[model samples]
Target chain A: MTGVLLPLLSFFFAASIVSLGWADMLIIVIYFLLVLGIGYYLMHFTKTGDDFFLAGRKMTMWIAGLAFISANLGSLELMGWAASAYQYGILATHWYWIGAIPAMLFLGIIMMPFYYISKTHSVPGYLKLRYGESSRMLAAISFALMTVLMSGVNMFAMALVMKVVIGWDINVSIWVSSITVMVYVVLGGLLSAIFNEVLQFMLIWFGALLVPIIGLVEVGGWSGMVAKIHQNFPAGDYTHLWSTLGHFKDNPMGIQWIGIVFGLGFVVSFGYWTTDFLVVQRVLSAKDLRSAKMAPIIGSAFKMMVPFIVILPGLLGLAVMPGLVGQNQAAMTGAQSYNEILPLMMARYLGPGLLGLGVTALIAGFMSGMAGNVTAFSTVWTYDIYKPLHLAATKREVADAHYVKVGRWATFIGVVISIGTAYLVQSAASIMDYVQALFSFFIAPLFGTVILGMLWKRATASGGFWGLLAGTASSIGMWIWVRIDPSALRIIAGSPDAKAMAEDMYRGLWSWVICVVVTIIVSYSTQPKAEAELVGLVRGCTDLPSEGHLPLVKRPIFWAGLILVAFIILQIIFW
Target chain B: MADEKLKSDSRATDSPERISIWFFIGAVLLVYGIIILIASIPGVSSPEGAQHVMLADLHAGIWWGALLIVLGAVYVAIFRPGRKKD
Candidate 1:
């Protein structure tokens, strides 16, 4: 421990970092108190497992909508994407725009009706409704493992950021944050997490918006920033969105338009935004079908604006603050890492009170992220895993209170495991990367299984089970194959010069295709369920709820169309 | 029918009596805004750390803080606990 502490202390000390003032400290303390207060307040209302896991299905559109996006807007995403913008240029906006908006809108306009109508407690629960037990258990086990590991990743990243930015001890940051999250989530469950996520959304926008606002002011404006970037790197075309993507080697990111469109836009984005339970759970808390559908649409609208605070800072760094380098280079030469661009910009512009708010926003982001994962983990554990085993043992239904009790315990145990995972990540950074990638491996295949089960009535239980298994296996196999032989990248990504990001996109596309094809083949060979059993589970058999009485302006499809128009306009403007 | 039953059952058990989430958001923002406004007062010496940033004279804290206070005020007024819904 002493040996680890010595090197870590020296590394952080060598970096020039800022300290917080009294006002900053006061603001942060207030936020911590407020979150815990929310938990205590909500504890009174939380009696059943429904209240603990699904917020009693009573969240308004705006509340659920803000939280739906906020759950994804973590410090890891904020810092990582900002760094990507700095390194890869405005092309990074593709992740927010093309990659996310389409899928979110699809979730609202197309997919949400099914999820809302089924009234299943979870995505895995829906799988059980449609396919059978095996598929649900597989998904639940994978989701539970991934969610807790991700909570740990968020915890470790928060500690690392605090240590780098304000010189806080790693252990102190990790434990304080983990304990805070555990207290609130164990107290009130998903509602507590949702409340904190909404607060986090507001704080992130208000706290970080100044960077892009002041940055654009300092660099003249968008045109000026673009010109300055062009001047800085005469050979690099950093500003154009789609114009530079004629070939893999044409852009700094080494990705082509095809990968952007099909791989990321269709496969990876849909898999995450549509199927991933963490974000989906937020929308599931909506009071009605319209609100549920509107939630993801509202989320997409907010998501489209995230690039201004995130990607704009990285672009601004390129225009103004040069000399930021890659991580290994930064460590070797005492230069700033691109990942530190967000904090460095905050330091450059924000003063005492605002600095504290900025830092608090980051802390809120990390905590909300941890809370989201932990709460989701607890829900899946109790509903999908623990309850099943208990029922098998007792052969009887337990009281709702018993499951609620189990959820609280699961929340505690999940946080403890996450802490252990965080410490493990601290020891081996590579473990964090693999865990994140491993989580991604499940997403594409899961999306395929869920979508097929929802859309096609012929999708058999065996087909859903085997298809998901094969898809996940193939994704892992491809990852290992590429890791073993560097030359396999040409076959996987279709370009010799394609970067790691492109590899991820293509991998998702292939795995999803494999899952779909296998499901069709196996589904044909296996016995299909009777039409009577398919109601409310598969699309054609289910009579979807009608919102035709709503005005055009109030309809989710209308707003989805408008959002799509705005999304296209953004692409053209950025291009 | 089942979905409606679930919705009404859950609604009957929760919703109306609980404290509003918006109130908490408003309260936090209001306090933070006031703190920031106080810190940004003219002739208050700038912190040792922020002395060198460009546009220091622009006083972004004042504008942002005022915006927050106004937004916070509206949220608190509209959604404060025990206020009757229209």
Candidate 2:
């Protein structure tokens, strides 16, 4: 204990000023122990593969909804978005609203019935049911790899936060967080992970709420913050959401509303919110069809408010910590830069005890993100990769206990590999760039295939496979083309001012277009499956039950409408 | 008979009908709130190793704690098994 304390003390001394007191440390320690305890306790409930992976298909709407957002409430959503807000101004909120809300609504209203009725364990499982083994294999392999890498990104981001705020060794932070996540997830599976996510969701709100509230007070109010931003950065349009977004050169984001609406909102957003198994898995865990549908709607409601916790801090950082941006300080040096805005705000505003909670909230965000990725990876590996191989070789169904064991082993192995990936991320130039590139490669094409297969009955299995392959290949090809000749990127993105993010959106849009066109042309040439065979898989072939029996307020459509109205109101207000 | 027993056991253990997560959350909030409130007293050692403190130091904990406890209670109340409609 003394040995441990000595190094920690020495590291603390070497690091910046100690922001946490003994009481704050006690609170953080207590929170960790409670999480571990919950994970261990939930393990006893997980007896089979279904229970382990899908929580016995018994999650309520609230649980599914909170977990859905919490799984995504990673350091990237909090810290990365805050950092983006600092850079791009309030225009970054479009990623939350236009980029997320409509897609979530589409998922709930249009996609849920297919996902729920099919009873597929994973997203690739859905592809297998809709398309064929070849498509399934392609998707499964890519998704499995992507999930693990994303987990590593989360791990890296978390370590970066700890290094910045607490002055801990990045490796130590990675191992500690990885081991904790592994223990809980390996023990209790998805249920424990979701449970902790819900807890983390609450803590995040509690921890981050103070920043915006205190900031608004200090800056006088919304009007005052706006005035400060305008006065300080005279050239930047930090307040307007859509009015200035006529073209790439017109706005701070350097992308037009077309990119925001079509690329991010339509292609990338739909691709991720609709098809990405990381979030969809939570909804799939819902006990009933209605609950599953309600989950994303609930999540969307919470998601609409997320810019408050995430982007507001960045805005405040702009007003308070002037000159924090454009510094490009190395993360390891613990220098206060734009990326450290969230923690810097907490350090300045939050006193000792609350500061502990704030730090814990950031840690919770990172851990939940890592845990969500690891759990998804383990499930995808076991169900999609390992089980398929095992079945092909043995030609037999394994016992539930056996699959459960494989899931646990996969979780352990996934975390270990993620630690390595985390180190790679640590060495990377910028984690945001790396993650966005991966998303364009995987998510954009996956969405194109999924949406086409779901909506178009004539989409052949061969078409699905080839189209996905082409889309992914094209995205990579485009990226390389741009990299080789910097001028080519200007042509591809349609703007000289297009940054990496704008380039990503354009790439997603072009890849999606390529995917859809290829799928249509190839599908016409290939043999199509019978309409009867495609029932429940295709949109028009299936008949969904009327939801009219429910009360107006209780209905998913009603909530979706209310959310849409709220969205319109926000757009108008910010316009 | 054995198969029937196994099915019944599985059904019973599969998923809890009532929500208990809020209860746990409430308990955590109550505990944290009490601890912070206790520590905020004049005699308790400040985490920053200071002898004196201000109302702002304890303000966040007390208020946030109270809010959490209330929210947890509301969740527990609303989600308790008897209130759930099929």
Candidate 3:
């Protein structure tokens, strides 16, 4: 704790003085200090990389679930996601009720069995155990590539919003957002992330849950906006929801409904909930297997409700923004940075004092998310990579002491690299689109390896390794193929790419198929590595008799049950 | 019935741990209810643009209704039918 206590004091001293005269800043400061203080205190708990990563595998299920949900829900989930509403409309978040909710519930019942059964930290660790060293290495590389790299997106988005609100320079906001996040995270590791998550979660919910009813009154209530909506966008064209809920009706996003659901919900959610390192680190830090599985499951269930707070605000925002409202239909549609839309509304509407509070809320969200990521980055490096090569300590011995100094250095180094890379990537344009697209690059590719590695004994590491490369390349290739040579894809896909609608439908489907095919082919060709004591580990996991080591259920009842439940939920959401 | 006795010293692996459904529901609902009621104090909705309604917080009375429904579903799902001991 002394090791943690010293650095955090200096960090807090610096952050407290960064901004001026914000009463809310003081409130946010209290939160910052408490989290930092507790995080520093808990450094006593982190003995090894495992403790740092999984809270020494001692977190209860409730804390694990809340922390997991809160970490995911940060500014990205709240402000940025709701701002998606501000930019587009409720249709953006309609995915929650339809796509996200079903995905989360299904994740708990289906994926939990595999994850808890593995008893590993991070998805890559699971691969290493089931597939082999080769697969583990690939999974790690892809995890770093997808999860770590895409994190720059959220950081960049938070910084951009700060620029809009306080008129702070983007680069300055970037630095402030990055440094503040690393401050507590480097001090405490996952404990800091978890503790801070408790506070940050409350702030986001308060912020998200606040905007709509207030906005509704400002916008002339639902009735006033109802008139304005009809005057501008024409009947039923403004929202897919108005015409037919959850089904697209001439919306510009043009994403096919099926693609949106499966690609975003199943593949993307699976990757994030089951595989993505940042999210996984949250689950990994859980006290035990039940907490790990239930964290995401419950987290997803919590997340499913977020649309009420975020997405609905966008529809409400339309009534207020001069850009979206006018005397006539043609006037409402025009060019603007939708990213600026939310902050602009806040600054214009909330008055400077309250506006400062909103900025502080975003900063809190930004810090919480950044801290979670830094914790994940540090955990993987120390546990998965460092301890394995350098230390000869026994597992129990490894599990019982403090490594704060090493952990802090890991965080500092990760932050520097991330900040440097984010600056380079800033030129790409549209912070939300760029980051999301980049996220898709890694998450889509690794989804196959994560699932196969868990479910099959034959999923050798060499296969896992090859499968990851193939999946990543295949996904990237699909992206490029769609953009550059849609014509070339027509032959392979047996659909004409010249048609925009065809291109849209094919892109999501092809990405999924390509990744899956490559993983299976590569996995099948590789010689299966005889894992050391495979049956023993599996038996120990299910706690079944030693002979069969078979799964607890005779058939795929759990997965089937989940799919049925998902179908039922989807029916209600769509019906 | 056999599964009932096989308890461990782990929150993650043990049988369903009871969560405070009331506290969770009450906190979110109470805050929202108070806020909406206060706003309807007939003065919080200041006319800024086309017309404006300001909420010091996000929660409102309706949010209580929504949360109760969701929380109820969550409670029903997590708590299984049977109880057991270590």
> Which candidate should be chosen as best, given DockQ against the real structure?
1
- Model with the higher TM-score, candidate 2 or 3: 2
Clash tally, candidates in order? 0, 0, 15
- Residue range B1-86, candidate 2, lDDT tens digits: 53333233323333555335654565666555555544444333444533222235435555665666565555445444444433
What is the DockQ ranking, best to worst? 1, 2, 3
- DockQ values per model: 0.30, 0.16, 0.08
- Pairs with backbone N, CA or C atoms under 3 Å apart (clashes), candidate 2: none
Please list the residue runs of candidate 3 whose C-alpha ends up more than 4 Å from where it truly belongs after superposition: A1-22, A145-148, A217-228, A241-249, A322-336, A345-357, A389-405, A426-438, A486-509, A522-532, A536-575, B1-86
**After superposing candidate 1, which stretches have Cα over 4 Å from the reference?**
A1-16, B1-14, B42-49
lDDT of 1 by residue, A140-241 (tens): 999999999988987898798888887878888889889999999999889888988988899999889999999999989988998899899889988889
Docking category for candidate 1? acceptable
Model 1 chain A scores worst on lDDT over the 10 consecutive residues at A7-16
Runs in model 2 with CA error above 4 Å?
A1-14, A327-335, A427-436, B1-19, B39-58, B69-86
Candidate ordering by TM-score (highest first): 1, 2, 3
TM-score of chain A of each: 0.97, 0.96, 0.79
TM-score of each: 0.95, 0.92, 0.73
List the pairs of residues colliding in candidate 1: none
Predictions in order: lDDT: 0.87, 0.82, 0.56
Which window of 10 residues has the lowest lDDT sum in candidate 2 chain A?
A9-18
* Error of model 1, residue B10, in angstroms: 16
